[model samples]
Target: MGKLYVVGIGPGSIENMTIRAMGAIKNSQIIIGYTKYIDIIKSLIENKKVFSTGMRGELDRCRQALQLSRNNVVSIVSTGDSGIYGMAGLILELKKDEQVEVIPGITASSAAGSVVGAPLMHDNCNISLSDLMTPYELIKKRVELAASGDFVISFYNPKSHGRPYYLKECMGIVKKYRGGSTPVAVVKNALREGQEFQIFTMDSFEEDKVDMMSIVIVGNSNSYLKEGRFITPRGYKLMD
Candidate 1:
C-alpha cells in the first residue's frame, strides 16, 4: 500500500509554500485538489496526474484521492493550511488502511495579515463566513462572541455570488460590538501576483467589495490605522 499526503500550498504562492508540501507533491504519483487550487500550483505539478473538482465536491475528491493512494503515492492539496479549512480531516476519516500524513502550510489569515500590516499581533481569531457546512446561526453566535471579546478577527470565505448576504449579516453583528470606526483590512488574492489590499473602517466597510478569494481582517478595540497600515498592538510595556 502506498502512502497518502495531505498538503497545504499556502496562499497560492510558490514562495509561501512549505518545503515539505512541495516534497510531498514531487514524490506523489497523483495529485488531487479543487480546480482553482490545482491551477494555482500547476507549474509544480507538471508531469503528475492531477484530479480536480469544483465547489461542494469535497467528499468525492477525498474518496478519489484515497482510492488512488491504495496503489500509488498520492498528495491531496489545499490552498492555505490543509487542517484549517482543507481536506485533511475528510481524508483521515476515510483512510481505511492507507498510511496518511498531513503537511501544514501558511494559512490565508496570516498571509493576508502579513500583507496588510500587523493586525494579528495581538489576540485574534479566524472565522469563516461561508455557511455551506456550518449553520449561519452558529457562525453568528461565534462572531458575536469574538467581537464582544475585542479579538482581532480574520474572516475566511467571506462572500460568494450564492451566499452574498452572509458577510453582510456577519458585519452587522461585528458592528454591534465594535465601534463604526474600527480598523479593518480586506486582502484579496493574498501573496499572489495580483494581490490587492484595502484598509477601511467598520462603518465604511462595504460587503459588496469582497468575494470568496478575499480575507477580511478586523481590528480589536485597541487597533488603529497609521501610515496606511492597519496595526493591532500587542499589549506590552516598552522599556524607556
Candidate 2:
C-alpha cells in the first residue's frame, strides 16, 4: 500500500488547482482522470503512468486507479471538486473492496461562485443537467423545487455534445416560478488560465454560450449582483 490521493483538480485549468492538488500530483507515480482532464495536465505527468478515459468507463477508471494505488502513489483527478458529481461517489461505491483518501478540490460551482462573489452565501442545492444516470422528469422536479424554494443553485454536468438543450430546459422550468430578469451567473474555464465569467439575467443568457465545460449558477430571491459579481447574503443580522 502506497498513498492514493483522490484529488480534485477543479474545473479544467492548472491555475485553478491548489498547491495541495499540485503537491499530490507532483509526488504521484501515477495519474488518472478523464481524457480531456488529463490533457490539461499532460506535462505534469512526464515520467509517471497516466490513465485517461471518457464516460461509461468511469467505473473501470476508478478500479484501475485503485488497483494501481496498491502498488504505487496514485492520484485520481476529477475536473472540479471530486465530491460533487466527481469520482468520490464512484470510489466510495467500491468502499467494500478498497479504502482510499478523498482529497477535496474546488468544485466548478465554488470556482464559478468565486468569480461572481458568493452565489451560495445563504443556502442552496447543487443539481446536474445530465440525464444519463437519472430521468429528465426527476431533474425537472428538482429544478422546480429549487426554484419554488428560492435556493441559490449551482449546477454541474450542465451540457455536452448532444445535450445542448438541457440548460435551457432547466431554465424554462425555473422561469415558471422565477422571473425572466432573475440573475444568473455563468462561469467558463473557471480558475483556468483563460477563465470567463458572465453575469446575466436568466432569460437573457444565450443557449450558445454554454458548454459541458461551463458551470451555471441560478440565484435565489435575495441573490443580487455587486460590481459585476452575483452574491447571496447569509441572512444573519446583528442584535445590536
Candidate 3:
C-alpha cells in the first residue's frame, strides 16, 4: 500500500503554505482537491496527475484519493489547515489501514487574524456558519456558548446565496452575550490577491460585506480596536 498525505495549502497563497505541505505535494504522484484549491497550487503541481471536483464533491475526492493511494503516493489538498473543516477527518474515517499523514498549514482564522491584527491573541473558537452538514440550531448554540465564554469567535462559510440569513442570526445570538461595541473583523481572500478587510463594531457590522470567501472574527468583551487594528488583550500588563 502507498502513502496518503493530507495537505493544507493555506489561504491560496504559496507564501502562506508551510514547507511540509509543499514537500508533500511535490513528492506525491497524484493530487486531489477541490477545483479552487487546485487552481491555487497549479504552478507547483505541473506534470503531476491532478483530480479536482467542484463544491460538494468532497466524498468523491476523498474516496478517489484513497483508492489511488493504494498504488501511488497521493496528496489530497485542503485550502486551509486540513484538519480545520478540511479533508483530513474524512480521509482518516474512510481509510481501512493506509499510512496517512496530515500536514498542517495555516487555517483561515489564522490568516484573517493576521490580516486584521491580533484579534485571536486570547482564547478563541472557530465556528462554521454553514449548516449543510451541521444542524442550524447546534451552530447557534455554539455561537452563544463561545460568546458567553468570552472566546474570540471566527466564523467560516459565513454566508452564501442559499444561507444568507444564517450569519445574521448567529450574530444576534452573540449580541445577547457580547456588547454592541465589541470589535469584529471581516476579512476576504486573506493573504491572496484582492485581499481586503474591514473592522466594525458588533452593532455596526454590515452583513452585506461578507460571503463564502470571507472569514468573520468577532472579538471577545476584552477585545478592542486601536487605530485600524483589531486586538484582544492577553492580560499582560504593560508600562505606560
Question: What are the per-residue Cα lDDT tens digits for candidate 2 across 1-240?
Answer: 676788888767777788888999999999998888888888788988888888678999888888888778888998777888788888877754454778778877888888878888888889988899889889988999998998987778788887778788888878777777768987887888678878888768776777776788988877777777687889878488
The segments of candidate 3 whose C-alpha lies over 4 angstroms from its true place after superposition are: none
Clashing pairs in 2: 10-79, 81-107
In model 1, where do residues sit more than 4 Å from their true spots? none
- Give lDDT for model 1: 0.91
Greater lDDT among 1 and 2 belongs to 1
Residue 184, model 3: lDDT of 93
Give lDDT per model, in order.
0.91, 0.82, 0.93
My TM-score estimates for the predictions, one after another, are 0.95, 0.89, 0.98
Q: 62-156 in candidate 1: lDDT tens per residue? A: 99988888899999999899999889988988888888999999999999999988999998999998887888899999999999998999999
Q: Number of the top candidate by lDDT?
A: 3
- What C-alpha lDDT, on a 0 to 100 scale, does residue 66 get in candidate 1? 88
User: Model 3 scores what on Cα lDDT?
Assistant: 0.93
Query: lDDT at 117 for candidate 1?
Result: 83
